[model samples]
Target: MTVAQLSPQSQVAALPQTWDLERRHQSMRRLVDVVQQLSLARSLEAIMDIVRVAARELTGADGATFVLRDRDQCYYAEEYAIQPLWKGQRFPLTACVSGWAMMSRQAAVIPDVFDDPRVPADAYRPTFVKSMAMVPIRTEAPIGAIGTYWAVHHEPGQDELTLLQALANTTSVAMENVRVWSELEDRVDQRTRELDAANRELESFSYSISHDLRAPLRAIQGFCQIYLEDHGDTVPVEGRPILETVVSNTERMSALIEDLLRFSKLSRQPLERHTVSLDDLVRRIVSAQRAAAEPGREIDVAVGPLGQCEGDSSLLEQVLVNLISNAFKFTRGRTPARIEIGRRSDGDEPVWFVRDNGAGFDMRYAGRLFGVFQRLHSAEAFEGTGVGLSIVQRIVQRHGGQIRAESAPGEGATFSFTLGQGS
Candidate 1:
C-alpha cells in the first residue's frame, strides 16, 4: 500500500537509475489499493473521494481535479490540490483541457499550459499549475476526465498515463454498478408498495363478504331451529325428513362460513412469538380428543419426542388441533385407531408431524389439500369444512415455515411442518 514518493523539487521525476523501479512498484501497489476501494463505492461521491486522493499520490501531482461531463459542459466537481484551481466551476466543453481529452477520447499531455492554445491560459494564471496531463474517464463515448497538475514544466511518462486511464476505466464500471443497484432497489420498493395496497383492499373485501353473508345464514338457522322445536308434531311423517335435511344443510353451511372467515382473518393476524413445547401441546390435544371420543371407540395415540420452537402459541396450537383432529376423524372405525405425533430431521431442518394409520388420500391430489373448501373425501363419509389445512399452512408460513403432506389411499397420511427461524 506504499505510495510513490517524489523529490521535493519536482512532481514528475526523471527516470533516475537509483529509484525508478522502486517508485514504479510503489505506484502500482497504490493503484491496486485504489481499484479495490472503487469496487465497493456505491455512489459518485465515494468514487470521487477515492480517485481525487489517488490521482495526486500516484503521479506526485501538485494538484488533481475530478471533472464530470454535464451535457456540453465540464464540471469541476472535486479536487485535491496544494492550491485552489477550480473546485466548483463549470466551463464550455471546448474551452478546457479535460473537455478536450474527453472529446478526443485520449490523454491530453501539455508540457507548458501557457504555450498550449487548447489550455485556458486565463484560468492557470491564478494557480501554481505550469503543466498538466488529463485522461478521459471512458475511452468510448467518454463521460468525464481525471486531470493531474505539476507546478513546473514536466511531461508525464507512459506508465503514469497508463495507470491514470486504468483508474478511469475502473471508475466507469463502478458507476455502472451503482446505477444497476439503485434501479433494482427502486423496483423492489415499488413492488412492495403495490403488494401492501392489494393486501389492504383484500382485507376490506373479505370482511364485507363475511358480515353480509353471515346475517342471512344466521336467520336461516334460527327459523329452522324454531320450526323443529315448535312445529315438529304438526309436520307430516314424510315432511319430517325434509325438515331435518333443511336443518342439516343449514348447519353445514354455517360451519363453512365460519371456517371461511377464520381463513380470511389469519392473513391479517399479527403473530405473537413465544417458546412452545410441541410435546406438551400434542399431549394436551390428544388428551382432549380421547375424552371426546365416543364410548367403545377404542383409540390408541402415541406421543413422541416433539421438540420446541419460537412461534405464536395460539396460532400454533390451532395448527396442531386441526391436524390431530383430522387424524382422529379419518382413523374412525379402526379396531384401534392409531395416531402418532413426532419430530424428525430432514437435512438441516427439524420437521414436526402428525401421522395416522386411517384413511389416507391419493398423492396425485396432494396439491389441493391446503386450498380452501377443497376436499377429497365427501361430507357424508368424513365431515369437515375443508379449511383446516389452509389455516394451518397460513400459521406455519407466518412463523417463516412450510407445511406439506404425504399420503396413499387406505395406507394412512402424515402432515409435516417446519418452523424455520422459529425452530
Candidate 2:
C-alpha cells in the first residue's frame, strides 16, 4: 500500500517552502511513537495519554485539546487531559472551533484565530488565546476534533498541520478498539446465562423421578399383599392363578423403582475407588441364591481368581450380584445348569464377566438389552424386572467405562463389563 492511499487525515501537511529538514525529521519520530503506543496499551485511558503526549510534543503548540462525540450531540466528550494548560477545559458543542470541524465534517486549520471567519467569537473572550489550529477527525464521518491554541497571534506552518493530522488518525483507530471490546464482554455474559438455565432444567427432571416414582409402587405392593391375605381362602381354585399374577407384577414394579433411584444417585455421590476382591462379592451373592432355589433345583457355580480394579466396593458388588442373579433365573430349567465368573486384565484394568449355560437371547434384540423395562422373555418362561443390565451400564459409565452382552437363543448368555481403561 502506498502512503498516498492512506487515510486523508494521515496526509502530510502543506508546509511552507522555507521549513528546515531537521525539524521535519523530529516530527516523524513523534508520529512513530503515537502508532506504537496505540498498538501496545490494553485499556482506553492509557491510549488517550499516548495521544495527548504525542500531539503536544510534535507541534510545539502552547496547549492541545482532543474531544470525542458522545451518544447525544449535546456534548462532544472530553477524551484526554494534557497539563499545565487545558487539562480540565471543555469546549461546548455549539460555540467553539472544535465544534466547527465536527459539524462541517472537515479539518479546520486556523493559522490565526482572530482573523479566521470560521472561528467562534464567544469562545475566546476571557483569555489571551489568539492563534489556533482545528482539524476534524475524519474517516467514517468526523466524530470529534483535535486542536492547539497559542497565547500570541501566529500562523501555523505546513509541517505543523501535517503532524497534527497524523495524531488525529491514530486516535480514531484506538477509539474503535474500545467500542469492539465492550461488545465482546456483553456477548460472553449472555452465553453464561444460557448455560445456567440448562442446568436448572436437568435438576428439575431429577426431582420428578425421585418424588413421582415411589408413590405408585407403594400402592401396588400394598393392594397385592392385601388380596393374598384377605381373599386367598374364599377364592375358587381356578382364581388362585390370578392372585399369583398380581403378586408377580408388584414384585417387578418394586425392582423398577429401585433401579431408577440408583441411576439418579450415581452422579451426585462421590466415588470411592478401592482395590476390590470381586470373588468375595460373587461368593456371597451365589450362596444366597443357592439357599433360595426351589425344591430339587441345583445350579453349579465356578469363579476364577478376579484381578483387582479401582472402584467403589459396594457398587461393584451390586453389579456382580445383578448379573449373576439374571444368569441363575434365565437358566433354571436346564437339567445341569452352570454359571462361571471370570476375569481378564490383558495390560488394562481388570474386566470381569458372568457366563450362563441356559436360554440365550437373539443378537438382533441386543440393542434393547441394557434399556430399563426391556424384556426378551415372558414372565412364565423366566421371571425378571428387566433392570439388571441397565444397572450394570450405569455403574460402568460412572467409573468411566463400558458394558456389553453376547448371546444367541439356546446357546447361553454372557454379560461382561470393563472399568477405568483404554488398553
Query: lDDT values of the candidates?
Result: 0.89, 0.73
In candidate 2, stretches whose alpha carbon ends up further than 4 angstroms from where it belongs are 1-224, 227-233, 236-244, 347-349
Against the true structure, whose TM-score is highest? 1
Candidate 2 lDDT by residue in tens digits, 15-119 = 322245667877897788678888776666776677666766787776766666553242433332233433345556566677777787666777667677777
lDDT score, candidate 1 = 0.89
Please give the range of 10 consecutive residues that has the lowest summed lDDT in model 1: 9-18
Angstrom error of the Cα, residue 219, model 2: value is 4.5
Return the clash pairs for model 1, or none.
none
With candidate 1 superimposed using the best TM-score fit, by how many Å does residue 14's alpha carbon deviate from the native? 15
Model 2 TM-score is 0.51
Candidate 1, after superposition: displacement of residue 61 in Å? Answer: 3.9
TM-scores for every candidate against the unseen true structure: 0.85, 0.51
Candidate 1, residue 324: lDDT: 97
